[model samples]
Target: MAILTIPVAYLIGAIPFGYLTALWARGVDIRTVGSGNIGATNVGRVLGFRFFVYVFLLDLAKGFLPTYLFPMAVARFTGHAVPQLGVFVALATIMGHNFPIYLKFKGGKGVATSLGALLALNWVASLAAFVGFVLALVVTRFVSFSSMLGGLVFLAVYFGRVDDPWNQEHLAMSVVTIGLFSLLVVRHRKNIVRIKQGTEPKVSFRKKHPSGRVAWVLIPILALVGAGAIYGLAAQANRRSELRLQPYDLTEVERVGTGHQRTERLAYADHGKLLAVTCPRYNRVVLYHVTKAEQLEVARDLELEGKPVAVWTTRDRLYVLVRPSGDERHVKPGWWRAFDLQGEPVGQPVPAGMYPDDLIVTADGRHALVLTSGRGEGDPKRPAPALEVFDLGATPPQVVGRLEFDQPGDDPARIKLSASGNYAAVTLLGSNQIAAVDLANRERPALISRSNLEQSEAPHLTESKDDSILTATTPDRDAVVIPWPKTVATRGGCIACILPQGAGLTLIDAATRRLLGEFPLRAGSLNLGVARPMGLAFSPERGLLAVATRSGSIHLIAVRDRPENIGKHEHVAASEHLGRRR
Candidate 1:
């Protein structure tokens, strides 16, 4: 995923929206002129209100189009859900605007990008969050407070379920994005505190604090909050560990109940027998028994005790997490750990705090591939974040090899393995490169780059059952689905359609290592917003293609007439529309 993310972040941040606005008006890089940051706030500081609006919109576009628009295009073209992946892509895009690699990795503070993220998720709440920030700015005259308070208020609105459609997975994503965004702002709390002291730089357009009474009210609230926490913890013996998942596929799946908050990843057991999903909300791992159509909380939160980010299973064994933990033995950080299906300690979690990110396992579950580093997590001081390859069958889950490029840091947006687990699709951020690695070669993974450098977010590689073909989804444009064959030899086909950016299923030429062209995927309808295809699986026996999206929609596609029926390349041909598809 980092492979594709580097270019996405670079290109998205390189947009120079703020700098361009500042330069067009004042002929200076916004960063050099104000706080020396090429972000909207910096632009607003230097360019004033009228010009800053344009900068803000442009900066928001850097976040919006890339994070939301781009992913929609890819989903429409590839017929896959890239939204779950889009979260990371959006994060990368935000990181790009905040700290662009082209600008020596120091860009803005990510306010605009975060606002764009909110907008992509839900326009109402995002707008409310925007109003919250504006209100803070209007009252306090402190942009930092406004920014922090905006996110906090948005988090509250998010957690409060204001205007949210009741869906646990969707809500989980909300908390995930909000928590991460809050952390980003929290890292700058010192600056926010300084602003409260009336020592930080103030935006000229904002008003002064309304009254001292508000601050007085805050005092009691803080005291009460602390008191509430103490009482809550005292009363609570265990963090709400009970979780029940209701599976909702378009056809045949039933939901017994819903999941608790903080859930990250989910995958089915053999023959979809059980759902082995990762729940970051309650900080536990859970296994849902599907036979009885009831969820049995098998194992709850079992990482290094930090957060279980991603998990994938083979059969009775599950390769749980691809994140770092406190190395009690090594006293180091950044590691990967594995647990059995029963949540028992299988092998010690590998430490890799130097690289903080996500991971994905191959379909066969034989190889555990790790990807880390993005935004603030990518540290140039230590070892560059890498793709640590581990052989799951090894007694200790031995590190067989790793994947890195000539680039200074990893920019992978998403790591995708073909349905058969034969090929690896890695999308690089801000660039047109998509490294197609062959799992057969563990020592040296091959690389591929697309032409035309655009802001492509999540790169999804898909394949059919019993078929060696694959396809790549470029999140930049929705008009054309570029099909890259996983054959590793020649460039392949490009399918043309009015598919939403990164939000549809696509065709693949698995033999040629090139795209076999694309067509509109029908039937699945997302609630709304950006529709990036999330996860995909093909039934070898049934020839059915199942695609799930972050918008909480699962689609069923049959492949009996897929080749001749699809790839005809007609936007009107698709039975599904972008609005419904999301």
Candidate 2:
């Protein structure tokens, strides 16, 4: 089904609106006109100015529809990110306009189609391209010269945006940009020769009659005013749409004690009965009893030596992954500490990893999964983060097996062990992929497979073999991991989307290694601002999925059959905002 995007886009681009307009309006073939090309300029020579406008707009739509709308539809339908795939569709549309097979391999110069494509891909770059065209045309009055310059400027403007995700992950966008630029230059070869010989035809804005010149001046002014008014109204409408997101009522606010103000990670324990929140500021793990209404009641604070960064709980045990405080003069290392469900110390702290970021206990509480963010290049031996499995049945948890990533920068942010303790879904922030580790093999945990998230082009980095595949953008603070219910048919797990940049949640099928759906994070009454997903917990029995943000706002989304579809209610978690609460 996804294979038809390119062919469909190509057919749309090959419509030849200019040729048809010339034939219908003047009974003359546009290909034999002034420029001997079936484009807006040649068609305008044979047909009236009105016909030229109609032909140009039709040509533009051919490129715009397939590039802008079709790929998104396909991506949504497929569940996987077809980002670079969209670039292919865009390129195909432009190529069809340039050398259409329907016209016996002869077609327009692709300037209009390219403009439409760039406009759809990146509107700012398209505007920049238009400015280049207008500037060049006004100075030289040569349409061919202006078209070539516009295409070049479009590429330059689009590529210059180093910060855009599309320019970074989708390297194919660069290829298309260069291809469009080259196509324009190659198609304008005759005009280049004419310009060099000082015989290029310059467009005369004025007609032979005085009234035609007056009409031209009046028409441009009217068009500019109409365009401005339309733009103003559209901008107003967009603002209204943005604000229309329903705001959810504040549900609850769990505050920290004095000096324990900075809070970090959140975890569920004892079948969703307990919520253990890590507060590094006071080196403690604060436990809470979560009510049915999704409110947190402070249960107890378990103090630890090192700073608590992440926590996980079993039916009878509490596991806290702690990192050494920077103020330590003796240079204490990072380790793991365990305690009973009642918050009593179980045993002495054990050596976990260099920088433990997240952990997940198995359903039976016999094993655990830990994700450690690597200590950077300062240390050569432990330069990369790893997925470590711990045998919890032992007195102090023992590291049974480990799987480290090849890239030193592959910093793992979160980990989720499946209900049956079969697999551990690990989100690697640095690499932008979710590595699913098979935990069934306790003696040797293996990295069974991985799935990429939706990603934009990473333009700054050199292209690798894997760069062709589109993945999700990982914000510095984006981290959420939730395993699917064992009873549910869905294979793997889901994660909260990186907000503001890539807004939505991504659900992946662990069994097939396929994306089930990319669901938006929009709720009934809440507007998602710079809401980074800091924590995620699923209530399968109640069909509720709760997402906690660093903005101190927790959003509850209802799920039906799958995470791909959003539920009825979504709102702020607590009765009061975290900042306002005592």
Candidate 3:
């Protein structure tokens, strides 16, 4: 019974006070537009005093009635100590109201809900917490800080008064309330910092919406209902699950300066022991012996050719695939030629008249895979629109195989390669499908998964580790690695990316195929490895994962610490075969 109480509390807490309030004000869903918080304050801020009152009252009703009055009803009907359970139920309601699961578990803080619970537990104590918040805000001018302290005060009120009318049997609840309140404070720790620094804005009752109702007549009533509704939901006994997450920091062990664009390309070889980076601005290849963390400018003399598109280095030679521009062809749809590290041409350019935007060289440096049409950033126009597999060692590429999808039906911008050359994952844009191919039989790659594409975006393969399909998700930009490590076989899978909106990264164990956890953005940087985080590179020598943003900052994050959403699954690849002949 006690075990069940926590889930119940979470359910009760999930109610959207601001949402209901918004509806009462405008007869519309608050989340559909504006800042989508469904609290009484937002209603007061957006809808003014008249409707703010309606919303606050409705919210208070949900907050207070569920936790207070409902428990009484149950207690009277059962003729038992139902109020004994009320404490647990009320706590659950507060959690549900703050962080609901049904609506992506996103909700406002629990002040109104807590007020409702306190009213149900003891009106005298509830009044004390309310006054404390108002007074603190008046003095410190920090609403968040006041809320934090007010919550503490509410928990504090139960302690000193054993003779108080409702103080006899609320120990379990007192502890739980304190714990939840602490979590809230921690989550709002940033706000606390702002408050301390005098940067936090005061809670203004001033109206900001032109269509909003009058402010003076609205706010108080909404607060009243917010209290009531929360208690009422508690009375109904709602349940919810809990989530725990830890934050991490991003460290850079090595970095190189370079200009960047959205369609940046990278190639790793020698089991990712060698990371080769090519930038249009640098117009050359930068090689790093990842393990030693040593970097070298192996070749910068490709002046006659286009910027480095894809690079691979064998033990004795280097092969680079370039899509030449400022010519008859556009940047992404231009000529793709191969050159040795000595700046010597290896083979005929892949296409006689067209350039390739993307490339993947074979493990032995014997072949080069090219993707055109899906070229040049995310323009969606001027798509080179074809696949060309070239023999890297050939004077001009020896066409090994090719595939082309109809326009609008397939926008193949994202691609991946397995170490065994057994599969290729393609993100078919303008649609939904994680295109899987059988690379084992080079002439014809078969589709293994097409219907279940969550989002086949920013795809990568653990080329060094052998067999994992790694893809970046849209919306959240999470790196997901699905492995078929048992043997070198092409496996079929569905399409998917980040999900449930606003949820953190979901880690899946390749072997068990179970979701490990929702990994948070552990790195301290405001953002990286996500949202058009166009570049990721793992340097085995440095034990670092390079995360790059379009704005031109590269972060070398340590992979060992298990950063929240940083590293990709298919860590590195071999490029001896993709380079010039020894």
What is every candidate's alpha-carbon RMSD to the true fold? 17.4, 17.8, 21.2
User: Which is the winner by lDDT between candidate 1 and candidate 2?
Assistant: 2
TM-score between candidate 3 and the true structure: 0.41
Tens-digit per-residue lDDT, 279-345, candidate 1: 4544566665543422233434353465566566666666555443334312335556666655677
* TM-score head-to-head 2 vs 3, winner: 2
Ten contiguous residues minimizing lDDT sum, candidate 2: 240-249
Please write out the lDDT profile of model 2 over residues 366-389, one tens digit for every residue: 777777766532355564678888
What order do candidates take by TM-score, descending?
2, 1, 3
Tens digit per residue, CA lDDT, model 3, 1-582: 444645755665676757865675579787765445676655666776566566556555656776665566655766654435667777777768777887787777666776777688767556777887887775545667877878776665544332112223334565666676787687577777876787766666445633335444556665787699557645422321112211122243443333332224444556555555665544555554455444433344345456655555565455555666554345333555555444466645555224444566666767667766553334455544556676655565577677765545565555667656677776665665556677776666556656445542232333335566564332224343332222222342211124444233333333323333443321112121122244554444344455443333333445333324323332111112111221
- On the 0 to 100 scale, the lDDT of residue 514 in model 2 is 34
Candidate 2: C-alpha RMSD to true structure equals: 17.8
After superposing candidate 2 on the true structure, give the runs of residues whose Cα lies further than 4 Å from its correct spot.
163-168, 207-582
Give the Cα lDDT of each candidate. Answer: 0.53, 0.63, 0.53
Candidate 3 deviant stretches above 4 angstroms? 1-251, 259-263, 270-274, 281-284, 288-321, 324-333, 339-349, 352-355, 374-384, 446-449, 455-468, 471-508, 511-532, 539-542, 561-582
Best by TM-score: 2
Ranking by lDDT, best first?
2, 1, 3
Error of 2 at 53 (Å): 1.2
lDDT of predicted model 3: 0.53
